[model samples]
Target: MHSAGDPAPPPPGGVLWSLAGDIRGLLMLPAALTLQVAHPAVGAGVDDHSVFRTDPWGRGERSLRSLQLWVYGGEAAAEEGRRLRKLHRTIRGTDTRGRRYHALTPANYAWVHATGFPVYQHASRYLVRPLTRAQERALYREWLQVGRVLGLRDEDMPPTIEDFWPYYRTMLADEVEATTVVRELLAVDAPVPPPDRGPLTLRVALRAAWPLLLPPLARFRRFITVGLMPPDAREAIGLDWTPRQERRLRRFGAVVRVIVPLLPERLRYLPRARAARAAWRAGRGRQG
Candidate 1:
């Protein structure tokens, strides 16, 4: 199942990019963004230009939409990548400590891009399914293509998926920090968006109950986010990660793995992914 955004599947061993269009990837968003902002430059960029504070969910929504289009959009995805690369070129500034930063810088872009592989790998264990080592490597290679399309050079990416973990671990140990912006993201105090297409009664109930639910939900979000992090990364971000928390997170993941597949397609995937799956299924039927 190929789409214009990501027109070709990874030759055979790549499962990560193949599943990039899955709604399951959203499970990794918090951790991915958290780790990216660990870089002071990325954090500073968001502080200066991103509307995350004012509209957290909206910012995430737009980011995810762009990714979906890039993966499933084909020629349209190329245009979107070009637009992003052009947009990023205009975003340059100095960090608080007088360090200069540019969104288009290969190193900066690569750090954010590299984080996606591990996030997807980790989240897939529960949100969807697991992959073998060969598939993981293939996924990593496929994303290298994505990085190139987004303006990163080959040298900017890790040489292989095997190389990515050491690089990722080093970034966590040496590069990531909890900036003020990251602290705000980890706080998770923003109101949850009400359901987009649920029954009016369900939406109304959720809206009315949200304030009451916010306290526990916020804690749960932080807990899960931290639980998803490695000790070094969690320590860098100053989030607590205890054995008890790990147990709870594991149980939650177990529940999701069992339940998510049972959800209706409308509930399980975003619109573009739903369409892509439908197209893939239709193509498979024709092949059959």
Candidate 2:
């Protein structure tokens, strides 16, 4: 239930609107999720409560949809925020280090959200054009607004882009670790099942070929997940990235940069984003 005075969703043409809905955004998501679970508390919550192992594709799809809604769902954004907070209320457990944890503890919850900014900033250097300094600040400000929509206080996040880096660095140094979930996410043999969505024929084909497909898919997953992470944060979490891998990632990104901008709107933007953008354009046309 949003009111007239409630903070608005990210504006339709904002940096988040442009980036969050873009297909390239999916490449950054695994790195962000990996970073989030590197924190023991977040790791434990997902390990114990999430069905990510049994339903990796479905989980990824749902998470991506929630992310899209945060920027493009308009009034639905605030309601989604409330639903997420409520969803996590009972997700309590002991982490790998035996520390008791709750999913919605301000710091833990905030850390999960916080991973997005750095991952976006870093990965954009390769997958999309680097953000200008002004664009970076604007992105951070808009992200903070999204935070507010998610029930985070002003104090829950760093107040500005300048303040955010130090806070992020401190978190990486003192708290982030290669927790069990982190290892699983980066594992090449983690036993993720074939995706169950799509046409029955496609699903069956995937299941039949999964044994042959999983090996390379897992390697690529690890490559993109670690390669897209901020370098210092990747080191902090102790993931290895060789120079050869770096070159490979750069070549891949170069291809992506050339190709993605050529895609049609319907192909480039996710479904929710494409629809919202259409609505915003129509409303603006009526006013004009």
Candidate 3:
């Protein structure tokens, strides 16, 4: 600590610069953001107030806390109550298209204030909630609860979610990065399939992810909150709706039942459905 007139300590070598670099890394890595966006319980959309940007190195001067951020994610978000009012209109809409979910896609980048579906296929089981502004810093605090409830740490966050892309220019970059990585990873040998694979059911992955979140989520209140909604909202929440997500979590505790183990391990050498039936039979055989 120092008196008001004491000289300030030298900053960590480019600490501000390092943060800026991380911002670029985050902006350029959309998969991380999409993962977080799609993470546990697809949201109604990131609560509008939680998105913020603080620039410590502006050209003019050092005026900390003086940055007046706007609700400017897009044209529709420029005003304070405007965004929420509009969201209230849509979220409360009851028509067919109104009931339809509005998700962000590479093809529809121009849609203002748009967001992707609730990406967390198993999030309902975790009882995820929306984050407030203070929790939005570099997404550092947002993931803290996700990590704690889901048992994750700050370092575990994907770079895409950590960067703060305040305005339009970088938001585009965020999407580009998320889509590109998904494409490359979906290539022939990639562990995860590309988008054209028709939304690869991370259900298996979610099942895999369950073990990671169980300890916390179990002591934590698994499903009751999600099942509060009707069964139909599954797609809207971005879940593959594998049994693990839709069925009660207590039914899944301490168990990992491979939904369809007989499916061809390397694409199709035979009718995939037959393989599934055979797998089911075999599983029953062992159980019997």
**CA RMSD per model (angstroms):** 3.6, 1.1, 22.4
After superposition, the stretches of candidate 3 with alpha carbons farther than 4 Å from their true spots are 1-23, 26-29, 37-85, 92-288
Q: What is the lDDT of candidate 2?
A: 0.92
> Model 2, 1-288: lDDT tens per residue?
876766667788988889999999989999999999999999999999999988888998889888988899888898889888999999998988888999888999899999999999999999998999999999999999899878788899999999999999999999999988999999999888898989999999999999999999999999999999999999999988999999999999999999999999999999999999999999999999
Tell me, by TM-score, which candidate is best. 2
What's the best-to-worst order under lDDT? 2, 1, 3
Question: Which stretches of model 1 miss by more than 4 angstroms?
Answer: 1-14, 188-208
What residue pairs clash in candidate 1, if any at all? Answer: 4-73, 4-74, 5-72, 5-73, 5-74, 6-71, 14-138, 14-139
lDDT by residue (tens digit), candidate 1, 15-103: 64357665666667778788888788888998899877666657777898888776666556666777788878878898766889999
Enumerate residue pairs that collide in model 2.
Answer: none
Stretches off by above 4 angstroms in model 2 are none
Model 3 lDDT tens row, 1-288: 223432221122212112211211221122223333332112223322122112212311211111111100111112322332344333321212223333222112222212211212122222222333432342333222222222222343333432422322233333222122222212233232111212357546555575555455433222332332223332333323356554554344223123213334332222222343355568778999
Best by lDDT: 2
Which ten residues in a row are the worst by lDDT in model 1?
Answer: 5-14
Model 2 TM-score on a 0 to 1 scale: 0.97
